[model samples]
Target chain A: MVELVVFVLMGGGALAGGVTVIKARNPVYSAMGLLGTLFAIAVLYVMQLAHFVAAVQVIVYAGAVLTLFLFVIMMVGVDKEEDVRETIPHQRRLALALGLIAIGIVVSLVARGRFAWVPVASAAADPQATNGTVQALAEPMFTDWVLAFEATALLLTIAAAGTIALASFRRPVADTAAERTGV
Target chain B: MIPPPEINWFALLPLLVLGLGAAAVLLVDVQMKPHPKWLVRMAAAVLLATAAGALLQGWWLRRLEAGETVGTPLPFSGFLIVDRYAIFGTLLLAAIALLGLGAGQRFIVSLGRRAAEAIALVLLSTSGFMLMLSTPQLVMMFLGLEIGSISLYVVAGFSRQERQSEEAAIKYFLLGSFASAIFIYGVALVYAATGSLQLFEQQELLSRVAFVKPGVLLIGLALLIVGLAFKVTAAPFHGWAPDVYQGAPAGMVGFMAAAAKVGGFAALARIMATAFEGYIETWATVVAGIAVLSMIVGSFLAVVQSDFRRLLAYSGVAHAGFILTGIVAGEAGIGSIWFYLAVYTVQLVGAYAVVAAVSGASSAGSPLASYAGLAKRQPMLAHALTVLLLGMAGIPLTSGFIAKFGVFQDAFRAGFGWLVVVALLASVVSFFIYLRVIVTMYMEEPLEDRVLVLTVPLRLVLWTTLAMTVVFGLFPVPLLRLTAISLPL
Candidate 1:
């Protein structure tokens, strides 16, 4: 009964947050809605006993990523109302139809009772259940997936260097000197 | 406690060399004064060395196979597979990077101080794609894709002074992230269905199980196709290609396009042929539908594009359709697909080299008018472009014809005769598009006295690509044999 109640509340909150993210005129409001949705999803993850994933979702996504989004929104100055004119012909209608089709497909599959909302537990104790803790995750990450782990370091370095290269412009020496002299 | 997975350093040498080269280039850039030419030369040397490493690995694998081998080696707990396929992909990616950087020298030099960063990003992107080609695990492939894609997003915006470049980067980033998310969702669904992330393990599990709930697995497969299709710029998912190609700096656009195609298609082929082999009947028809749509849409669209870069983007879509036709034949067409990709990428880079020379390297919006009287003003570039365009159009006595024939034959053998017929018609229409450009260059009078000068590196790229095109057209036996040898293990 507690699980049922929690699922209902979190799912409702997630839906509302997603709607607000789409409908809100202000960029900051949209970002806030996104944060709410993320938090609700994190709660859902926790309900699934994925505590590590839930914590990371809260910390990395709701905390860090949402904050970055807000910072960008503020820097870009979200005072003006966005232009809501449709650029492509029939884009909204097409999107609506496609969305309806996708939802229908999912609903029909669920109606057929072929799509399980929760994973079926095995007769034996689940290895993954015991290994859901941080230590178990870290063991495979450091051992079996070590190459990928090291490769992530390279990816991050490349991203850092690429960001600096794309964002920072080096003016000619003459321009720098002139600017320094208040020209 | 679980035992630690065994590491195979020899299998990973090519990627390691590339990573070290990227770091070395960045460090060298900081320590010494920035000379774009010197940095490009250094990057080229690094790429050449990396390619050499890949070749050495290939040679070693052949020796192993000859001496004694029951099955292909799976290194890193089956996260990576070392075989002729991976080596071929790595060597091709390295070569494409070298050619792209070589052709992009003036553009990098134009950046003044950020040349090293540009070079490093190219190497990093190449390594990412190389890793993607070598991996057998879905998550590892995703990481490789992200690594390559994030670098490309930045590279797209390298000309920061231009509004269009920034727009292109933002568009690419938002859509790319969405696609990646969809791909991961598919991965999660597949895991839910089969309880495995490794491709081979998933195959085994799938074949063993009756799959009481197949809807989720089918949806997962569709999502995988959608994500990969978006990357390869297949029709309906190809909205970003034209804008991004037209907006990105001309010198690097070829590399970006070629690298992404090589990696994305390599992964797609592997996943379809290896993991989803049991569901060939289900996927083959779906792939055929996409192929038909892409060909029709790409051909008609190419005929209408006034911008040369956008035309090439559309042509790329058409070529992707051709390759997908081969893929629809299942594993039998993997060799044909690789051959098509290898030959097409070389010609693509060569064609873009001409564009980079005609338009300034950093400039966007290469209107077809720029090529007016190209033959009169710059005869050699015009000739090179003529050959390249002919190759792209699949004219007789060019490598493109052989590639088209191979794929069509594969599709026909697989009972996709209707698709092959549609593809032939699309190819003919696409030929007209290429012909239009050729006519504009040769027949149309000069708009202005725009001096088209080819830099030495650009010259080297063009000559090599051209020579390869002609040689492969005349004698495809060697390349055909090589591609046949590179099947996924």
Candidate 2:
């Protein structure tokens, strides 16, 4: 019952936070809301018994990625809300209708279905038999996914360097008046 | 109690060649830079060489069965299939990648720096594309997709000139990542129900499981379709296409649109043909719905577009819809789809080559208005573009028409006469849009001030492709026969 209560709280918190992230008027507030959602999702992951994935979610998404998001928001200095594009009211209504229908379908699926938790046999559970911890993950990471992982790092590095090059090449605007007067 | 299948290195040789080539090119680029401006060209040459090698290897492997060499399912535990179908597709992809390399040279020079990296990325993406075609497993499917997509994200913003390019790149990245994440989650759920990632295994699981599992599986399959359909730039997920295509360098856009769609659809075909065969009735309906929507939306949106690249982007989406008509029809679908993609690659690259040659003293490629006096100035390019436009319209005496005919023929053979009707309607709509460009080129009065300067190499490529398009259209029997044959899904 306690586990069920925790799962419910985690799911509810995450959903609420995600909605707030989109709905918040302030950009900073939205980022904070995203952070809350991310944390809740991490906790939900733990509840699902994906402990390693839960930890990675907390560290990578909530800790590092969110910090980067926060930094970018500050750097951009989004002081006021940008003027909203005047989308048709009917579009909003249509989107809401679609959302409600989707929610209804999902709810019906859950309510009608008798989903039993059939735990996989422990022998079949660990894809890697000898070491089923982080070491197992590492073994595959180093062997099978090594090239792809290296490529990911390379991609991130190149993105960083490219961003820097682009950011640094911002030339100052020439004075039009001075040029006109030949000063 | 059976041991898992062993890895099949020989079957995966094409991907290996592409990967090794890219690494070699990267090393060469880093070592011998700043001295030769043509270092990029040299690397491109190496890629072409690798592509040639892969083609030869593909031919050898494909003919192995004919020669009575032992041929069975690869021991990669069904992660990949080693068959004539995949080999042929890979060979075609290699040729397209090579052509893209040749066209990308001037565009990369215009961008300035990272030319080597861009070339390497293309080769890498080609490798991913090869893997995508060969794979029967979902995990590798996602891996190959990311490899192609991430490369394209960088390639789209290769030029730093316009804010639009940056915006295009970011939008493509964010939307693509989100879609892929959704796809992965769906895969996880499917795996949870099925206990295996292989399509064949999943099919067995689906058959064994009850109705509720099938329902969940259907939802998961829908999500997979949505994600892949996005990659292929089907209408609903095609919001990024036009802006991204316009903002990206013409060569990259051409390559990505053609090769990426081929890879995505290859995997889509595999999924539908194998695991989802049991749910064919369900998936067929959904796929047909998407096809109809995509065809209507893409062609209609393309018709009014002034920008040539953007129009082509919309047209690409429309072609994807047409292709999906075949995919929806199932087993009878695969051959025509492959044949159609080959025709598409040739025609799209040819069109973009013409665009690259024509586009101006201003940017990477030409504007629609810029083509006004093109017939008067650069008759060769105008002629080539006309052929390309005709092919795209599925006009008589062009490869596009042959391809469309093949697909429609397959649909009818598969007992899908109604689908053929819908496809026919869509094709007629597409014809109008494709003709719009040609009409603008010929019938409209030439704008007095514009002068077109055509590059010799681009003109040569254009003319060659135009001839091939007409040739294939006329003598399509051989290709048609080729399309009639099928390999394992």
Candidate 3:
């Protein structure tokens, strides 16, 4: 009964947040909505007993990424509500039609119980036996997957250097020359 | 307590060299702050050294093949394999990077103080792609793809002076991230269905057991194809290619386009031929359909492009189609696909080098009119462009012809003759697209008094690529022999 109630609350929150993310007229509100959605998903992850993943979901997606989104929105000064005019031709209608089709397909699939064959986590006999803990993850990450883990460092290095190269401006030669002359 | 997996130091030496080179360049850039020319020279030396490491690995592989030593090709707990196929791909990627750096010296220099950053990104991206080609694990491949792609996203926007560059970067990042998400979801679905992430394990499991839920597996396969198709710029998924190609700084556009194609196709071929070899009947038809659409759409759109960069972008789409046709022949056509990629990418880099030289390295777009009377002003560049275009057009006596012929032959043998027919018709249509550019360069009057100049490095890159095109066209036996020896293990 507790599990059912928790599922209902989190799922409903996620859905509401998702809808608000799309419907919000202000960019800041949209970002907040996204944060809510991310938080709700993180809660769902915890409910699934994926504790590490849930923690990462909150710490990374909700914490860092959402903050970055909010920062960019503020930096861009998009505090004002956006114009609600349709930008693309028939975009709304097309979106509505596509959404309807998607929902219909999903509903029909649910109605037909097509997902009945999906194996439940309970089938594992002991969920803890599968070792989805942080230790289990770290073991492979350091042992079998060490090369891939090291490669991620390379990726991060590239990203850091690349961001600097793309965003930062070089000191103008004129300024340096003037400074040298003055000295 | 489980023991750690054994390390294969010898097999990983080339990647280590590349990683060290990237770090060394960054360190030197900060510590010594060398002149731009010295930086370029230092980067070149590092790339050459990395290439030499790959050569040593290749030599070792050859010795192993000759029964001089006993060794298993699978390395790193089956996460990566060091076979002839991986070596061939590594060597090809290294060569392309070397040529790109050589031709892109001017562009790098144009970056002013950020020259080191550009060089570092190139090396890092190459390492990512090299890793991508060597890995058999799906998750590892995804990481490699991200490393390469995220670096490229930044490289595309390196020219901060131009709004178009930023636009290109944003478009590429958004679409590319979407593709990555789709790809990972596919990986998840596949994992859920087969309970394996390793390609070989997946293959073994798939062949042994009849899947209870085949729909999930099939959807996973389709999504994988879609994700990779987006990467390779196959038709319908190629909408971002032209804009990105045209907007990116000219010097590196060639490298970015060529490297992505090489890496994407290598991974695609590996997955399709190895992991899904059991489902060839289903996949071959789907791949053929994509091939036909790509060829027709690419050729038709390329003819209408007035922008030179966009034209090459569309032409690349057509080439992707041609490669896919080779892929439709399954494992039997991997050699032809590699040959086509190796030759076509060299030509692509060389052609874009000319574009870079003519339009200035930092220029965003190359209007077709800029090439009017190019022959009169820069005879060497014009002649080189002519030969390169001819090669791309698949004219006789060019490498493109042999590459096209090889794939078409493989496709024919595999009973994809109808797809081949469509490809042939599309190739004929593409000839006009190349001819239009050539005629503009040779016959039309000069639009402005602009002079075309090629630096020594750029000249060397062009000549080498052109020579390779002709040499491979006439006597493809050497390359063919090498490719035959490098079949996926």
Candidate 4:
């Protein structure tokens, strides 16, 4: 019952956010919807026994990065009066076809005698379970995957440097205006 | 589930070396001052040495027969495989970087700045690429992908002063991060259902309980495909390619597009071949859909682009679609993709070199119109550019044509006949765009500002690129044989 409820929440979140991703008038709102959907999905992960991944989903997706989307939205803030394009006429047909195909697949699976939802065994004992915890994640992370981890850090550093470089190079508005004015 | 199989060290040595080399370059750049070209040279030399090591590794692996004794595994547990495929691809990428940089010497020095940091970053990016190609584990794969991606993000905006470059960098970073989140989430779900992250382990489980975890695993696969698709700039995920390519410096743009795509496809190949192989019928349809969309969208889009760099970006998308067809073909497609990427890296890097040389002043950037009267002004460069362009168009006598031919044939052999048909049609559509470039250069009259002058090294690079394009296209038998031998049976 808990799994079903969590699934409904996640499914609902996904449907709502996916629609808003295309339908929202403001890109910022669309980004917010994406964030919400992502969070709900992370909750689903927790219910599915992916606790560590759920935490990572929140940290990496919701916490560290989506802010970039917010920043871009604010930076490119459009006027409220600007006309937003709605979905095209043929889009609904595509959606309908996809929906039908998906339903067909689901119905076929149900017919195949595979809906047995065996409950998961009780969560492993605490000591054993802790080994699968985030703390344990650190060991393999540092030793086996150390090179890749360090590489990520280096890559991000370069991105920072590049960002600074690009910002420094933007044409000053005064110069653009001067050029326009035949200065 | 059984834990991952024993670590294969020999198969992972190249990645270890690349990682170590990247760190060394970063430290060296920090400690040194911007002075003579020696710093760039040193960085390039280190990369070349690494490439040499990778080449030797490939040769040794090639020497292994069907029943030869296995070699010792390289360090870092069992994350990466140091097989010939990884070694060859890594070496090729490194070589392209070296040659592209060497040809770009005047261009960099003319910026009145040091190339050390930029070169170091490029080297580090290549090292990330090495890891990306070789890593067999999902976590390791993600790590490699991010390292390569972040490096390219910085490289895209390396010019710093150009607004377009800034816009491109920001757009790529934002979209890429979003896609990555989706991908990681999918990974989490897959792990939840299967209790494993290694491909073979996932595959083994998938074969046994495919019906049991159908919903979760299928969803995971879809999300994973979306993530990888975004990396390769496939349809619906390719919004950032044109702007980013146009904004970046030509040399770096070439490296980013080729190296990044190769790494992305490598991971894609690994995933489909292992974890998702059991559901070939389902994922094959999805991949086919993507392949068709990418072909149509990328081809038509390229025909309309006014910027040469942007056009190439679109062409890159179309090429990605073609490559994916081979992937959709399943087993036969894997080795084909490896071969095709090798050809692609060469042609793409060569083409971008030409673009960099012609685009003037390292700062003004390459506008499509700048090529007006290119043939009259610089016959040699024009010739080389034409060959590369034709190669990209997949015309006969160019390596690209043969590469496409081989993969499309492979697709048919693997039971994706419809995909091959769509691929051929896409190729025809792409022909117009590629020829548009050729016509603009040859038939179109030169504008007033057009003057072509070639430096010695630049001339040499152009000739070499041109020659290789023809040689590989016409005499592909040897290359094909070599690639086949290298591929895991």
TM-scores for the candidates = 0.83, 0.77, 0.84, 0.76
Per lDDT, the best of the predicted structures is 1
Better of 2 and 3 by lDDT: 3
Clashes of each: 0, 2, 0, 10
- Quick one: RMSD of model 2? 7.8
Where does the lowest 10-residue lDDT sum fall in candidate 4 chain B? Answer: B1-10
Docking class of 3: acceptable
Compared with the true structure, what per-residue lDDT tens digits does model 2 show for residues B458-489?
56567667876898899888876766664554
**lDDT tens digits by residue: candidate 4, A17-101:** 8788778877887888888888888877666556778898999998878987888777877444655465687887888999999
- Model 4 pairs in collision: A165-B160, A166-B160, A169-B161, B9-B73, B9-B74, B10-B73, B10-B74, B11-B81, B11-B82, B12-B82
lDDT tens digits, residue span B1-489, model 4: 224344444554555565566556545656865552665566577777777778777666656644365654343554566665666667777766776665665555554433544665676677776677776677777777777787777777666556776777788889888988888877887887788877767888888874754788788889889999999999978998888888876656777788888888878887887677778899988998998899999999999988888898899999989998888877667767877888887778777778877884254257678787788877777888899888888889888888898889888987889889989999999999988888889998987555655666567667777777899898988888866654431
* DockQ winner, 2 or 4: 4
Report residue B473 deviation for candidate 4 (angstroms). 1.3
Write model 1 residue lDDT over A80-177, tens digit each, in one string.
Answer: 66678989999989999999999999899989988466644321335356434567688888888988888898788887898789778754588779
In DockQ, how does model 2 score against the reference complex? 0.08
Which ten contiguous residues of candidate 4 chain A have the minimum total lDDT?
Answer: A119-128
**Residue B180 CA displacement from its true place in model 2, Å:** 1.7
lDDT of 2 at B106: 70
| lDDT for residue B307 in candidate 4, whole number 0-100 | 84
Best by TM-score: 3
Better of 1 and 3 by lDDT: 1
lDDT of 3 by residue, B130-170 (tens): 88888889999998889888888888888856668888989
Which stretches in model 4 have alpha-carbon errors above 4 Å?
A1-183, B1-13, B16-36, B59-75, B111-114, B361-365
